[model samples]
Structures are given as C-alpha cells and as structure tokens.
Target: MWRIVAAVVGLYRMVMDATRELFIRILMGILIFLGYVLLSLFIYAIMRRIMVPQKLHTLPVHLQYTPGCSDIQCPFPQAELILNGGKKLLSSGQYYKILLELEIPETNANQEVGVFMVNLTFHSTDGRYLSSSARPVMIRFKSFLLQILYTLFFAVPLLLGLWEQKQVIELVLFESYYEPYGDGALSALVTVQHHGVQLYSTQLSIEANFSGFTYYLYQWPISMSVIVIISIFVSLCTCTVLMWVSDVVRDYDEQRRAALQRRRMIQARTTGQAAQNGLGTQRRGRGRQQVGSNTALPPALEETTGSEISSEETSTVTGVEDLASEMGRGQSTPPPSITPTEGSVTSSDYSAGFNDVLSSLHTLSRELDGQEVGVANRNIRYRTGH
Candidate 1:
C-alpha cells in the first residue's frame, strides 16, 4: 500500500514538472492575444474618429442688401453684411439672437420723398432659400423663455448622454468589483432641421415661404469601447502577474514538500537503523546468557560427582576399621594352636588389602579432580571462542 501511494505521488510530481513550461507558455499566449486585441481596438478607435462624421452646429452665409428704387439713387445700395464670418444658421430646436447694425444718411427737407422696398433673401448650401419683404424689419422679439426652453431641449439630452458615458466608463474600467448594471452598448441619435422665414404683406395680401434644410445629428459614445479595450489590457497584465505569483507559490510549496519528504526519509532511515541495532543487542544478550548457563552447568555437575566420591571413600574406610578390630579379638583366642608363621602371613595379606583400598581412593580423587579441571578448562575455551 505504501509503495502504491509513493508511486502515485512520484507520477504526479513528474507530470507537474513536465507540464510546467507548457502552462507558462499558455499563459504567455493568452497575454499576447490580449495585447493584440488591445492594439486592434486602439486602431479601430482611431479609424472611427477619422471616418465618422461630426455634427456641424453652424453654417456660414453671405448676405447682400439691395435698395428697391433705382431712380431714388438710394445711398448704401448693394450693402454686404457679414455675420459670424457670414451669416450663421441655427439648427432646429436651437435658439440664437442675431443683431444687425446699419448706418443711414439723413435726407434734405427740399427733396421729394419716395417709398422703397428692399428684398432680403437667405440661401442655404442645399439650395433652400428664404426671402424677406422689399424692406426688412423686425416684427417682434421672440420669447427669451421659449428660446431658453428650446436650447435646453437639445442641451439636456446631450448632457445626460455625456454623463451616462462617463459613468459607464468608470463602472466598466475603473471599478474593481463587478456588477451587472446598465446597457452593454451605448448609442445616441439626434436630428435637427432649419426652416426659413415667412413674409406676409397686408395690403398686397400675399405670403411667401422659403424652403428649409434638415440635418440629422448623431452621437455615439466611444468611451465604452475604449473602456472595454482598456479592460482587456488590464486583465492581461493582471493575469501575467497572477501567473508569476502562482508559479512562485507553487515552487515554494514544492520546496517545502521536498523538505518534508527529506525529513521523513531521514526519520525512516534512523528508525530502521535503530531497530537493527536493537536486534543486534538482543542477540548479544542471549549469547551471553547461553555462555553463562553452559559455564555454570559444568561446575554443578563436578560438585555433585565430588560429593558422591567423598561419601563412598568414607564408607570404605569405616569397613576397613571394623575388619581390623574383629581380626584383633580373634588373635587372642586362636594363638594356642596357630603357629607364628601363619600369623605373619595373615598380617602381610591384610596389609596388602588395605594398601590396595587406599590406592583406589587416591586414584578416584585424582581422576575426579582431573575431570573437574578439564571441564572447567573446556568451558573457558568455549567462552573465549564465542
């Protein structure tokens, strides 16, 4: 079981080491793609700026005023007026005031008086025109409050769109925390038209109207696009940084694991060595015990044999003394019939038998002592050999 676990761990480590470079390459590729996307978006923004049409809030115009009477020889006939580099035109839903200043000459009292009418016309680049009466005059001042209201009508929505674009940019690009809010795409469209003036004559009972031109105004907020591009760029950078940090962390963890494994291996080796040492010590202890038992056995056997031999010698000696006493008593009673020669022969035989018993006891004691010495010597030799 432990072998299987170790094999699995080794395989995992090998796989990680083999794929480490591949993982890094993949991260780098993602970062590159993100950078490419960011560049493409930047180019697109530039192109859009160059290609997209912008709204023109004003137009230039040239105005010429001619007197109606030729015979009256009116002064300042064919007068040219330039307003705002010519005459500026306002878009529909927009209000502006135009102030015109003209110098007139005082007529002499004797000269004949004549009524003159002048025609004032306004023309646009699109071929639309507006004409005034023979003499131009202001009918009345337009409502200042109404003009302000008209200005606000166009201005408010434009301001709101700008504000919305700003908010969207901030939320999408700058905000770290994510939230699902607002529209994904931003767009704005505005349309405006310019209509020419109307002239009415009470006595002639005639009315004239000029054609006017219409322009369409469009505003697209590219800020959201820019935000998306910026977000991609930022995300790529963040991913790169995170990948680096993760790699560092992984390396640190691997090092730590390696250190731990090394420690475990050292511990295992130490423990195994200790076990072997313990076994060796136990064997030595058992060997010593066996030697001691063997050495002690010989002494005990020798002691038992010596005690038996001593007891047998004591019994023999006692028997010998009894025989000698009996023989002495018999000598007093049988001396009358027995000769001295026979008595001498019997004494010699008894002496010979006692000497033989003494010799036998001496031989037994010498053999016992020699055997005990030999056994002790053998035991000592065996212990030294061990």
Candidate 2:
C-alpha cells in the first residue's frame, strides 16, 4: 500500500508540473499577440482621426455630368452644383448648358446603382428671365476588399501630402486680369455661358500682396496665404535639421581624430619604455619556459593583449608562457620579436588603444598632491624600473 501511494503521488506531481508549464507558455503567446494587435489599432486610429479629413477637403471636385448635360432636363433630387460665384450678367430668353457631377458613397448593395436626371438653371434679378439645360450621366463606384485596404493604406500618406493644400483651386479666369486707374487695384470682367445663354457674368477686382488694393474674391487670400506659410515653415525646419546633423557629424569626427592621435603617441612611448628595460620578450622557446615556471605572466599577458591585441605574432606571444610551461625548465631564451611591417591596423586596434590611452591620460586624476607636473624646480619622481 505504501508503494502504491508513493507512485500515485509522483504521477500527480508530474502532471501538475506539465500543466503549470503549459499555462505559462500559453500566457506568453497571448501577450505577444496582443502587443502586435494593439500597435496596429493605434496606427489606424491616428490616421483616421487626423489625416482623412484633410484629404477630403482638398480632393478635386470632378464635374461628372457637366459636358453632356444639355439634354438632361428631368428633375433629379439631392443634386448640387458649385461655380466660380463671381459672375454677374444675365439676359432674357436664352438657355445655359450646365454640367453637374455626383459622387456616391459606399453602400451595402452588391449591384451598382445608376445615375438619374440632372439639370442646371439661372434665375435673373428681375424675376422674369429663367434658362435651364442639363444632360444624362451614369456614375458608378466599385466595391471590393482591396478597395477598403487601399483606402487604409494610402490614407495616411495622402493626408500628409495634402495637409497643406492651400492651392486648392486653379481657376482659368476669362479676361480677369487688369490694372485700372493707376491707383486702387486690378479689375476685369469674366463670363460663363451655357446653351447660348449667359449664366454668370461679373467684374472681378484683384489686389496685390504688397500693394494697397482689394479684389473680388476673398477665398484667394485664405488659400494662398495658408499655403505660403506652411511651405515656408516646412522649408525652415528641414534646413535646421540638416544643419544640426552636419554639425554633430563634424564634432564627432574631430573628437575621433584627436583621440586616435593621442593613442598613437602613448603607444610609441610605451614601446620605447618596454624595449629599453632589457625585457624584449619573444613568443617562443627557452626564455618563455623559465618565466612560466616562476610566475603566471603568460596568461596575464594573454588576457591583457587579447583585449586589444591583434595579429598572429601577438597571439603567439600571449601563448608563449603556456607553451614554456609545457616545455622542460632551464632551456635557453628565444630570439627577439619585431613590429608589423605592412598594412593599416584594424578598427579593433583603435578601440583597444582608446582604452589604454584614456587610462594613461587620466592617471593624474587619482593624485592627491598639488605638485606642478612640469615645473623645473619640482622633484619629478620617476616610476620604479620594470
């Protein structure tokens, strides 16, 4: 019975361990999925809120039903028209050919919807003359999954591109450019005619930016001024950022070159000192053997040299002590080593040399005494001979 109870308890513990691990794995997977989903949602919300509205405002209003609207006399509800709004002439017993364009938003119906009757007419101020003319048009918008994706995809870029859409309208004014009386402003007459009837005729006055003049259309100033301001701001910001980046790169390059020069100087000094001490160590044979047997110098050299050292010779020098221990003691010393003869040093050497040079340069930082370093009268104590 004791044996049976022990086996059952062991099986229960195994099952509990497996269950706990599975639960933890599942939780981790869920968190990763949620992280990606939330990020996508945040991007979508930002584009929809700030970008879409701006694009809609600047989108060109294409007059879909304008050119062939002469035969369209049937009344179509929910149809509207937009014009230059600066015309002023009308005559009796004449019809104006008007163009109308319509845009339909997305609908749930699977089949395409067709356009109905559309027309345009102008009423004179005398309440006696009225002219009307129009044409039949068919406009249809397609629906697909890709269309929805495209709308989302282009929504943000389009918004940013059109964010400063100050040049929203490019009107071809008919003879609407002239300066009058050498004084106030420029004035000209413009006319719009349809079906042999004048729908709009007006005299427009244009004011210059610097001159003391006022004109017919106020919309011109709003659009042009806003666009100019935004363009200037964007240009200034771009130039500023470029200047800042260039300055940073220049400063960084200067510091790097200075550091390199300092490193080379310190390395030359160290090499001179090492050579002068009669300790011109080589990487082989009898001398290494004696040194290894007496001290742990070989491994320490390997560690220090390996941190910044390169080349086959450097590595061999590092392994010299280890090799010496392998050899029998009391062997004769090896030949002298030489510096590298050719090719530029590696980036690794620069990094290594940086550390060594920095340490040496800052050595005086730890000094507690206030003695002048280079004074002729000072007791310039030298370090002990290596």
Best by lDDT: 1
Q: Which candidate should be chosen as best, given TM-score against the real structure?
A: 1
TM-score of each: 0.24, 0.19
lDDT of 1 by residue, 1-386 (tens): 99999999999999998799889999998988877786767765665443332333222222222435334343333322222234322322322222222222212210122222333333333334332223332223335586466557768676776422111000011111111122111111111111111211111111111122211112334654565566756776688799999999999999999999999999999987876665455435324333222121211111122223344454543453444355445541222232345324354443444344334334433433434332222211111010
Model 1, backbone clash pairs (residues 3+ apart or across chains), number: 4
The CA-based lDDT of model 2 is what? Answer: 0.37
CA lDDT, candidate 1, residue 163: 23
Deviating ranges (above 4 Å) for candidate 2: 1-219, 279-386
What are the candidates' C-alpha RMSDs? 28.6, 30.1
Candidate 1's TM-score: 0.24
